[model samples]
Target chain A: MKIIAVCGMGIGTSVLLKMNAEKVLRQLGIDATVDATSVAIARESRDAQIILTTPDLVDQLQGLPSEIVPIEHFFDLEEITAKLSASLL
Target chain B: MASPKQLSNYPALAKAFADNSIRVGAIALDREHAIEMAGELLVASGRSTPEYTQSMLDAVAENGPYIVIAPGIALAHGRPSEAVLEIGLSLVTLAEPVVFGSEANDPVRLVLGLCATDHNSHIDIMAELATVLGDAESVNTVLNAVDSDQIRLLF
Candidate 1:
């Protein structure tokens, strides 16, 4: 599966989100490639199975085929674990 | 605290804290005030122009409070541009929590300001920072830190 972590600027929190998601995915034994991208580029990733981002950015990703997951706290591994599990597992 | 191996791999983080860019138990009147303090730290460290501070506020105004990336922390930054003279990070732990209009991460007590000359230069710094902030124990230490020395020891 393919996952994308997004923020206004791809270089900041999005990268952090991508790392955390990769950790959670690994712990869950889920095989997926997670990429961190900007708001503009994430919209073009049509093949992404899940898009993890802040709640405010969720509407910006609407109409995409991917499951747009609204992440409340990027540092919360339990939250990320539960969200990804419900969506992917 | 980050592991010794982790800090060894990301020496820039240790350098940043050693430079005294961290303010512990600061008082911020509101969310914007918290972000402004973070920006001021970057400017005080000579990492970015004074104008970079306003740009961070503007980004939050335009993009909302997504910078509140964790339950009690907000990382303030704007796009890479001329305002940034170099890559830097500044951290401030508020004496009183302030709301940033984030549903999940409201009342942020820690504000981290970041400035980079370009997109890729700070990737390692961000990764190191993520490792430090990702742990709840470390987050607690950050929130309760009484001085910058205590924070520096975390890395």
Candidate 2:
């Protein structure tokens, strides 16, 4: 499976989200490809199974082939862990 | 092999804060002032040009406050542009939290200004900060820190 962590510019915030998401996938003993992309790119593409982003940005991705998983708290690892388990496991 | 904690790049982000660029006080006004202060912290430390703050402000006006990365914490940054001078970090805790009008996260108190020379250069430090601030308990600890030393020692 593949995941994309997205934010406004795919510069700072999205990169952080991508790293944490990779760590979560590793901790769960799951193998998946995760990429950090900008909101614009994520909106135009559907190259990943799930697009992880903050709740607010989800609206901007109105019609997309990929499922948008809006994370409530970006810093919390436990939240990421639980979200991944529920969706992928 | 070292544990996951050891592998984290908290040290990289820690150095910027170690340069004594943090300001903890009751800085009032609006979100722009808070962001400007955070940017000033980076500029005064020689990490960025004056254009860095303007770039940050422009990004907000164009994209909204997507910088509010977490509850009570705002990670302010702009793209790798001419405004960027160097890689830097600035942590400012306000006495009164300022609202950035983010739909999800608002009333941010921790303004972490990220000045990256390029888009990819600051990824390591940004990831490190995210890891270090991953837990509510840790976030609370940093929020309650009495001095810059206390917060700097966190990373």
True interface contacts reproduced, per candidate: 0.72, 0.52
- For candidate 1, report its TM-score: 0.91
Segments of candidate 1 deviating more than 4 angstroms: B1-10
Which candidate achieves the best TM-score against the true structure? 1
Candidate 1 docking band: medium
lDDT of 1 by residue, B33-134 (tens): 999999999999888998999989988898788888988889899888999988889999999889899988888999999987876777788778988887
Q: What is the TM-score of each candidate against the true structure?
A: 0.91, 0.88
Candidate 1's residue-wise lDDT over A1-89, tens digit each?
78999988787889889989988999999889888888889887799989999997898889999999988888789999999999987
RMSD of each: 3.0, 3.9
* Candidate 2 error regions (>4 Å): B1-9, B135-137
RMSD in Å for candidate 1, one decimal?
3.0
Clashing pairs in 1: none
